[model samples]
Target: MPSPRNWREIPARYRLEAARCRGCGKVVYPARRACPACRGQEFEKTMLSWKGKVVTSTVVQVAPTEFQMEAPYAVAIVETPEGARLMTQVVDCDPGAVQPGMEVALVFRLIRREGHGGILCYGFKAVPAA
Candidate 1:
């Protein structure tokens, strides 16, 4: 990601900071100006739980150029206890082993490096909870 884009997402990507719409009590990640549910402009900042359960998952057999080396990895939509869902890579286990309702803990990890500049991007990856 570009520096500007990456920097703007540090709160959500690094701290799991999110916004809760005051009008409808809806939560959204990456804190937007308006709520998708109610178009409410008023919001309060909130932090998401580090733990969640996999809602759904898929194995990527063919990967994009940036992620080719990690092909056949598992990606899932994990729903935190607060009811906020985010798509993340499920790591530290066999990709095919990831399943719906599986408990996972988010851990900080290197996401990817930008081309040429090698700017390191860090984000959360889900690992099976013991």
Candidate 2:
């Protein structure tokens, strides 16, 4: 059971919420207090488009202990049309097939289970856009 504050702090993990900096018009994901581009404090909430293009990607042959079972996966930096970029796992296809400029759609999925409680963590994963 996550606290309300925990959930509130990460709307982007669940809903793709982002912040548009009023100062520089930069859109940042995982909405932060200050804009990275202009160091602005004012922002307007925005929703990122579910679809994006992979800017870069790599096939993970080695993974941390917690993720070894899911190794040989593809990790990519995806950029939305709004200019928000996020690192996300790419799934539902061959890892070797993922490449830069590939189109993908962000989808809500289980990331992993944590602790003895096996609390399921959920986040977005990118899949090949049909």
What Cα-based lDDT does every candidate model obtain?
Answer: 0.93, 0.92
lDDT of 2: 0.92
Least well predicted 10-residue stretch by lDDT in candidate 1 = 1-10
User: Model 2, which residues run further than 4 Å from truth?
Assistant: 1-9
TM-scores for every predicted model: 0.94, 0.91
Superposition-based RMSD of candidate 1 using all C-alpha atoms, in angstroms: 1.3
Across 49-73, the per-residue lDDT of candidate 2 in tens digits comes to 9989999999999998878999899
Which regions in candidate 1 have their CA more than 4 angstroms from the true location?
none
Query: Candidate 1 local accuracy as lDDT?
Result: 0.93
Write down the TM-score for model 1: 0.94
Q: Across residues 7-37, which tens digit of lDDT does each residue of candidate 1 receive? A: 8899899999988899999888778888899
